[model samples]
Target: MTELLSDQRIDEALQGLPEWRRVGDAIERSAELASFPQAIEVVNRVAERAEAANHHPDIDIRWRTVTFRLSTHSHGGITEKDIALAGEIDDVITDV
Candidate 1:
């Protein structure tokens, strides 16, 4: 199992991910797409990536806004996996 990230490490990771913020034991980011469909499209793309990474995030969709919350539940806190997936989510956003 992956180890949980330290607060210092989590802060460091968020430095590069301006869109994502540390929220308690998890990190979250919200994106506003062009339209509702566009938002769903991004979610679909994120879903694919999440599947590929085998690290699924909690997704909340409301109209054109989609929020993703990442946490390694099994590990009991945030971890490198969540950070890596956050980076991937950012990439997906720009690619969409």
Candidate 2:
């Protein structure tokens, strides 16, 4: 099984991911897009990245806003995978 990240490591990772926050065992980020279509586009892009990585995030979309909660479910906490995926998500959002 993948190991959980230490609190210090999680904090260090969050420094690079300013928009994401730790919530219990998961890390989450929410973005508000310019339009509903744009939000969906971001979600679709993130979905493709997530599938490619085989690490999925819990996504919530409301109107023009989308929230992503990522955790290594098998390990029951944040891991390197969550941090890496968060970076990928940020890139996708920035690109889209």
Candidate 3:
């Protein structure tokens, strides 16, 4: 089984992810795009990366804003996978 990350490690990892914050056992970030279609495009891009990594995040969309919450459900907490995917998601947000 994948091990859950320790609080210290998660904190350190989050240092580089300014837009993301710890929320209980998961980390979350929300991005606002110029239009609803652009927000959906970001979601679609994130979906591709998540599928490639075999990890997924819970997503919520509200018009031009999208919120992503990631956790390693199998481990019941955050893991390196979540951190890595967050970075990938950041990249997608930046690209779009």
Candidate 4:
């Protein structure tokens, strides 16, 4: 089972993910795309990564913006998995 990240660990991870912010026990980020279709495509990529890692985020899709909030449910908070997946999403979407 996954473990919850400590406050210190979460802070350290946030340093590497400047685009993400802590909201309670979750990490949140918003990415803007060129169009709705492009936003959906980004969601697809994030879904694949989430499934592969067995960790998922709450994704909100608007016209051209996608918001992601990630936390480890089993741990009742965020974990290393959330940070890693967030990084992967950042890498994929930055190139889009």
Off by over 4 Å in 1: none
**Residue 54 Cα positional deviation in candidate 2, in Å, after optimal superposition:** 0.4
| lDDT score of residue 58 within candidate 1 | 99
Q: Report the lDDT tens digits of candidate 4 across residue range 1-96.
A: 578889999999999999999999999999999999999999998899889888889999889999999988888899889999999989879978
Per-candidate clash tally: 0, 0, 0, 0
Any idea how many clashes model 4 has?
Answer: 0
Candidate 2 local lDDT, residue 80: 97
Candidates ranked by lDDT? 3, 2, 1, 4
TM-score for all predictions?
Answer: 0.97, 0.98, 0.98, 0.95
Candidate 4 is scored at a TM of 0.95
RMSD of each: 0.7, 0.7, 0.7, 0.9
Give the lDDT of residue 85 in candidate 1.
96
How do the residues 1-96 of candidate 3 rate in per-residue lDDT, one tens digit apiece? 678999999999999999999999999999999999999999999999999999999999999999999999988999999999999999999999
Q: How close to the true structure is residue 60 of candidate 1, measured as C-alpha lDDT?
A: 99
Question: Best lDDT goes to which candidate?
Answer: 3
Q: After superposition, how far is residue 6 of candidate 2 from its true place, in Å?
A: 0.2
Model 3: lDDT of residue 93: 100
Tell me the lDDT of candidate 4.
0.92
lDDT of 2: 0.97
